[model samples]
Target: MTAAPVKNLTLADFLHLPYVEESPAWEYVDGVLQQKPMPKTRHSMLQKRLLTAVDAATEDYTALPELRCTFGGRSTVPDVAVVVWERIPVNDLGEPEDHFTLAPDWTIEILSPDQKATRVIDNILHCLKHGCRLGWMLDPDDYAVFVFQSQRETEVFRGDRLLPMLEGIDLSLTAEQIFSWLQVKRR
Candidate 1:
């Protein structure tokens, strides 16, 4: 027997569904769904390193990995999500949900070569507007990072400077160090 055709679901409908085990490659934007292509090796490595460093630095807090969150009907899975320890919600059993409903305190996105800068910037801006305290857009090719804070201005860092948001956290990696990690060695 032929199966019934599935209807295209809106972002609202998507959220009502059960939680997914694996993070999907789709993002919801303005009531429409968009697919993100698989990240390249450099993109993947940078994302992993950033997540590791951020988690290590904020060990006192409750940070999560690729957690699904919604902001104004848009569902985005940020590369790394830092949730302030105190602000974390407790469940009936006195445990926090694996996924968060609100925007994270910090969101970081590593731009893939094929991804559009405007789109990535929009995501950062969206996070800021929705109460995210900090956001970072790392450009692998240019070795630059664009930092954004809610209710504040945006800043760009290049070369050998430490990021401002990471000041209290004491992260000392420079742009050169970040890019160098992406390089492959010849045997």
Candidate 2:
């Protein structure tokens, strides 16, 4: 759903809008307010499992789910946003800051059945353009992962092929292994 604004709303206007925690996330892209589709069962499951896996595999980085990051004149909520430990913003008290004013080091987007792939890819590209090290778009139905990095051709990994990871991240995951997380009982 696109919110109809009486006039073209600027990023400043979007930043001032009331944020409701329970509502579907609203993203500001290209001066348009776009509502992300509610996550479905597969999407939710994959997001949860992937987040858990990434978190467990890295000590130098943190993976947060549904984090809203603002940069390059856009606000986006990636399925999983990974930031290097030292790069995470902290308050005066040393606690993590509530708002991110920059792109994540690594952005992950899970493909929802109703979501447009182009929009998702656009956000990833935006992050890359803003100095993000890596991005991954996971397609559950296809059991594939589309990888993006700075100055590199996009690659699709499937089955047991190892998916790319940010530098210093020792964990290795395959598209099949990721999609297997959705199965409660493995064959």
Candidate 3:
């Protein structure tokens, strides 16, 4: 006996299918399912801290982790997706919508060691192409960050350098302070 050949599923059918527990993380890209690498300890530490920092830093917008946002035939789970309070999609009941059918105002991706840099960058670029105002690619390996405002504009920050975030976000964060979160003191 042989397994059935995988078919290109429509978005409706894809959503209806039961999620695979082993591969909890899934993304539909160009009609194909892609499994994402599991985040390691360092990645988790950074993600958690960054999420908290960004969430509190902005009164105009809020940041969240691993939020699945769908648009343009792709469902991207950005590490952190920030949306302005007014722009958040709401249903008839005046509550947050179950499905995010639009791009985030800001998309942040923290590059896992095993993940391809280009693949991560591609998601950021995708968000930008769809009206995202800012994108941040945090590289834990080098304690550096890549800020992308536009297709042709980018800047690298490291050490004590201040990281560029969305305009109107009142947080002042430096690469060094962010990288220091990885430091753990043990007996």
- Per-candidate TM-scores read 0.82, 0.93, 0.88
When 2 and 3 are scored with TM-score, the better candidate is: 2
lDDT of 1: 0.73
Q: What does candidate 1's lDDT look like per residue over 71-156, in tens digits?
A: 66678877677777776778899898665678778888888777778877888888888888889889988889888987678888
Better of 2 and 3 by lDDT: 2
Best by lDDT: 2
Candidate 2 stretches with Cα past 4 Å from truth are 1-6, 19-22
Give the runs in model 3 whose Cα sits over 4 Å from its true position.
1-7, 20-23
Q: Model 3: which ten-residue window has the lowest total lDDT?
A: 1-10
Model 2, range 14-101, lDDT digits (tens) per residue?
Answer: 8788862345788888887788878899989999888888888889998998998988999899999999999888999999888898
lDDT of 1 at 164: 62
Candidates 1 and 3 compared by lDDT, better number: 3
**Model 1 lDDT, residue 74, Cα:** 78
- The sequence of per-residue lDDT tens digits that candidate 3 reaches over residues 31-65 is 66666778889988988998899887878998888
Which rank order by TM-score, best down to worst? 2, 3, 1
Q: Rate the local accuracy (lDDT) of all candidates.
A: 0.73, 0.88, 0.81
- Residue pairs with colliding backbones in model 1 are none
TM-score of 2: 0.93
**Pairwise TM-score winner, candidates 1 and 2:** 2
